[model samples]
Target: MFPKAHQYVNIHAHRLAISQDEWVLTNLFAGDDFPGANETAYYSTGLHPWHIKDADSEQLIKKVELAAENLKVLAIGETGLDKLIQTPLDLQLQVFGAQVEIAERRGLAVIIHAVRSYNELIEFAKVHQPAAAMIIHGFNGSFQIAEDLMKAGYYLSFGHRLLISDKLKDVVTHIPAEKIFLETDESEHGIRELYKVVSELRNISLESLKVMIGENVKQVLRIR
Candidate 1:
């Protein structure tokens, strides 16, 4: 049988767990070395758009494909468009699309890293319509954008941005429990703190929020 859900589910994190209570889905950027055999944490692997210009993307994608064979590898990204970067949108699309294809083939969820490219991301989803759950990590968009993405059948994951962005707080309050997740996402803030903030915003008990997100991780991400 698969493991039961833990008290805290960090959907996207860069570091290993600081405590056993947290089930951290660590992000492994392609081209980086894989964790040691003794490592005991879930991971999402893909070619990050920012590193495409600096690395052999095809080789890195091959690495991702190999990594996906490991049951510890639960999702296919931290891969998506980033308009703020110098990487051409076309190249980003090509690379991101490749990773999405892997997720579709592997029956895994996708942890997306979008930046000022939601419209294009939505269009891409409409066209390809990947079966894997597309989770937009560290989402800081307006309610309308969130609604549109949800309407297109995507999930929103809030991280450190939830602490400072009033707009994001509003988004969290209304996002359906089943479609929402929380993460740390390379930030200094703790996942537990983010959970507390979200519980208050949604006017639900902290325990209830934890149970809901745990179930979402299992059902939406299909993690046993």
Candidate 2:
């Protein structure tokens, strides 16, 4: 979650954070400026689409390639299709497709963005057939869409919306532990609070669920 919303990272028994929360928080949209190595402490990289507009696409591509070479850059993207935004759909698709291609080449997992463009996103997935497992973050789609993606062997990430949706609870009930994750996304809800609800819904202790999530992060990110 972002500081502008909840305004703080409330660390608790929730260890779903494979790395420190602020590390994931601050650099979430740092884009090509995202760390390759850190002197303070190491942080993981998550490629985001929002910042793509600010940089030269060609230069960013090479920067991302270099970032991918770093062991710390674990995820290929928060990149994908979004139809609701003001940005041109064509450019979004170009950046999205390019990142997917680079991810496939680098053996990195992806954090995806899919807003009002599931059909197009699914089609891109068909062509890319990315080797990295993708986690569709902030998933608020219908049960059928979630089921469709699940069947495609992609993991799903949940965030603030889970605090509201009963339908999501039902959908979550059917998903296996290995494929399930909880994220703050751009939401204010603390990760600890998320675990409280998720642990209850999944019928597992908060500690156990956190462990499962940590393992999922490791497997998906291919982190040592």
The weakest ten consecutive residues by lDDT in model 1 span 1-10
Q: List the global CA lDDT of all models.
A: 0.87, 0.65
Clashes of 2: 0
1-224 per-residue lDDT for model 2 (tens digits): 12222122221111224434332422344343555364332233444556667357667766777777766666666677778777788888888777777777877777777888777767766776767777787788878888778777678887788889998887777788888877776565777777788879889886677677766655666542
The C-alpha local distance difference test score for the whole of candidate 2 amounts to 0.65
Over the stretch 1-224, how does candidate 1's per-residue lDDT look in tens digits? 12245468889999887887788888999887876545677789898888887358889989998888777788998899999999899999999999999998888899999999999989998998888899999888999999999988899999998899999999999879999999998889999999999989989998888889988887756553
Best candidate (score: TM-score): 1
- Give the Cα-based TM-score of candidate 2 against the true structure: 0.80
lDDT of 2 at 9: 28
Where model 1 places Cα greater than 4 Å from the true spot, the runs are: 1-6, 36-38
Question: Given candidate 1, what's the lDDT at residue 43?
Answer: 85
Clashes of 1: 0
Q: Which stretches of candidate 2 lie over 4 Å from their true place?
A: 1-27, 30-32, 36-47, 52-55
